[model samples]
Target chain A: MKHWLRIEAVCASLAIRSRMAYRLDFSLSFIGMFLAHLALPIYIVLLYGVSAGFGEWSIGDMLLLTGTIQLARGATSMIMSGLIWHTNERVQQGTFDLLLLAPVNALGHLLNRSIDFEDSGLFLSGMLVFIIAVVISGITWWQALLLALLASFAIMFFASLYILFAAITVRYISTLRLFEFQDIAAQYAQFPLHIYPSLLATLFITLIPLAVVGYIPVGVVTGHLPMIMLGSLIFPVLFLGFSVWYWHNTLTHYTSAGG
Target chain B: MDIITITDLSKTFKVPKRKEGLKSAIQSVFRRQYETKHAVKNVTFRVRSGEIVGLLGPNGAGKSTIIKALTGILSPTSGEIRVLGFEPFSQRKDYVRHIGALFGQKSQLWWDIPPADSFTLSQHLYEIPKQEFERRKNDLVEKLGIQDIIHKPARNLSLGERMKCEFVMALLHRPKLVFLDEPTIGLDVFAKQAIREFITYTNKEYGTTYILTTHDMDDIEHLAHRVIVISGGEKVFDDSFAALRKIAGVTKHVRVVTQKKVVLPKKGVRGVMHISPYEAQFVLDREILGIRDLVKAIAQKTEIIDLTITDPPVETIIAQLYQAKA
Candidate 1:
């Protein structure tokens, strides 16, 4: 375990150095992401105002939902989502051989080296809105703590799904473009799930599960969801378990087929 | 002790068949058809503790597949493989630390990061002691002449420079066994020589066992003591370097210089390559005709000035083997 931590630190440091090399580009992208996240709540407020709110979900609820999604996306991207984007290229070029040969767990090493510091701006912006939404919604400090815990769990849960995406890419090299589906799922979190059609909502809660990542946390904070729903917490554990198992099973079939 | 052992090993891949046009691409996805490819078929071989074995084969002959299986990148479909007392696929995390591999076509170095940074990452992954890592890093950098390029990002480095760093990184762990796949594929003569020297140094100084696969026969000729030839996913030949030439029926060129003008012996000679009053050269298949007999016959005609025997080039011998199989 100590060795794994050391390896993770090395991977993170390498990623930081590489990003530091493009300071100007990193700064520009950070500003763009910050502006994009900052403007998101305004758009939600305008939409909710014109629509006179969404199914008892006021503008404050929308803000909380959007902020939490950004928080979850930023956290996931900072650590593991980049591997989803890189999996296809690495498998195609056969460069993933290095990861397989590393002394560390292949999945952990891949996730570790992929840390993206550019997401920090978005994460900070989301945190600021999250705090404001908590105050305006008059949630207790304990509930805020619960929201934070659920958000962290959601990050792991989403990261596991992306791992499954990456594994699929490894198994079928042609399916690399399917990685965009991850972003599309996260995009679903910006709005209230009940506003969508019932079928879509069912899919979101079960098969797709994007709403479960952030929406449920907001629901719990606003008294719209029972505290017993914390049992839903076990779902991420199961998802992560399945994801890890599927990844290893698919890896055994990695043909290293391409030239 | 044997560093590697394999028996009846095979690997098969289910390659999804592709059809032309947009409609077929969509339709095939729903009703997928696969073709089973036997990449390695019931092949088997072993290597002792400190031996360098060259894996020779034509394209698609499964040389790379075997290397991948041994290096724990791909699991075998059937049969058993034990390397360094571990099943490479099942015990990958523990087994890989004892081995190193370099694919000439694919680099391990992070393209956007300096080679030094990659080296540091490797140091952490391998968990080498700080003092030991620094010592080996400095020694290999100087020996491979990569000190100047080690700090530059891998993308900016030339192919040869990147390859050198690749070697440095693979060796940094000081693995007991190493697999080198086409390690000198696109290198200049000087770069190729440097790599050959590194292999020699590592093998001698560290007793590192090696499994080298290359289409470059020069690499096999320079680095490997034994050669294993696989053709069509089967072991066609496995023997020492000198024995490979003989197995391929490659002839030896014999030139004899006489003190005075003499008549050349015509019997038992496959081809009289060159002829002069005092000197003659013949290409002789030693299997059919013995070198000692020919020299005795030549000396009986006139006092021999000098005698030289040269084996055919390894490239020609391998080409002949491939052609015969084709």
Candidate 2:
């Protein structure tokens, strides 16, 4: 395990150096992610101006939800940026074979290879919004802790889902549309689950579960739907376990590049 | 002891078949068709420790498939394979630790970074001791004359330079077995000689075993002691290089330049390929006429000035082998 950590560190440093080599590209992507996150709040504010708020939540509560989702997305992007894009690149280019040749944990190395240090700015901006929401919500300290903890797991939840698609991409090279699925999930999860019909809300929290990642955590922080928060904790673990099992089974489907 | 052992190993691929026209295209979407390609069939061979064996074959003749199976890139469809006391595909992690592989068409180096960074990354990946890593790194850098280019990014380096660094990376861990798939492909003569020399030096000095696959016969002639020829997904020949020459019934061309014109024997020798006033070249099968007897016969007739004997090039023998197999 110590050796694995060292290897991860090495991979992270290499990733940083690789990005540092292209300063302009790194800066542009960093600012682009920061602006993208900020743009979401602007859209939320504009929606609140037209309509009082989303369902029972006020504009301030909706801001908290948006900020929480942004934080989850930022953390996921910063830590696992390479998950989708690089996996596709490696599988198509047949370089994943080289990764498997390494004696260390191959998945760890792959995750390390995908780490994007450029998303640091987005994480910081999202954190600012999240803190402001926490201050305004006037929730107890424990509620804030629970929200933070669930939000962290929510990142893992996103990872599990994205990793499943990564596994799919490895087997069937044409399944890059999974990214679009994630995009749609993220778009819907930005608002409260009640904005949709009851069945769709249940599906978002149960089947898809992106709603639990962002919206439910904010709901718990605001002292609304405390019961859903407890269930959110269990769902991501089961989903991640299922994702890992699927990943291992799909490994056998890897036919490599050439016949 | 054999480092690699295989018995009746085979690998088959299911390739998707495409149909022409809009109607067939729509049908393909509903029920795709696949054609089974038997890439490797009933092939078996073994490599003893400290041996260099060359895998020779024409294109699409399953040479790469066998290498892929041995390297754990592709799992065998059937049969058995043991490399370094482990089944290659099932025990890939343990097996790969004891072996190194280099593909000519694919590079393992981080293209945007200098090879030095890659070497450091590999040292950590392979878990080599710091002192040993430094020692090996310095030695290879010096020997391969990559000191000037080691710090340059791999993308900026020449193919020869990049390949030298690749050799360094592969050998850094001192693996017992190494696979060189077309190691000298698309290299200049000097670069090829350097690579061949490095392989020989490492093999002799460290007792490393190598399995090389290439269409370049010169690579086999220069580096390999034993040759395995495959055709149509089967092992057609597996033995020492000399044994292959003997099995092909290949003859050596003996050119003799004499001080005076000499009468050439029409019998006993296969035939004279070319003749001039003072020089003659004859193709002689050593099994039919011994070299000593032929030289003595020529010397007896005229004073010999210069005589040179050369075996038929490996390309000719390979062509004949493939033709015979077909």
Which candidate comes out best when scored by TM-score? 2
**DockQ, all candidates in order:** 0.56, 0.44
Clashes of each: 0, 0
Native contacts retained, all candidates in order = 0.80, 0.51
Error of 2 at B64 (Å): 1.7
In order, candidate lDDTs are 0.83, 0.82
Interface RMSD of each: 1.3, 1.6
Candidate 1, A1-259: lDDT as tens digits:
7887888788788888888888998898888877888887878767866888778887777788877878887778777767876777788777888789998788888887667778787888888888888777777878788888789878877788788988998887757566677667778767777789999987776766666688788887787877776667677777888999999999877888543
**Lowest summed lDDT over 10 consecutive residues: which window, candidate 1 chain A?**
A174-183
lDDT of 2 by residue, B90-157 (tens): 78777899999898877888888899998988999888999999999999899898899989889999
**Every candidate's CA RMSD:** 6.6, 5.9
Q: Give the chain A TM-score for each candidate.
A: 0.91, 0.92
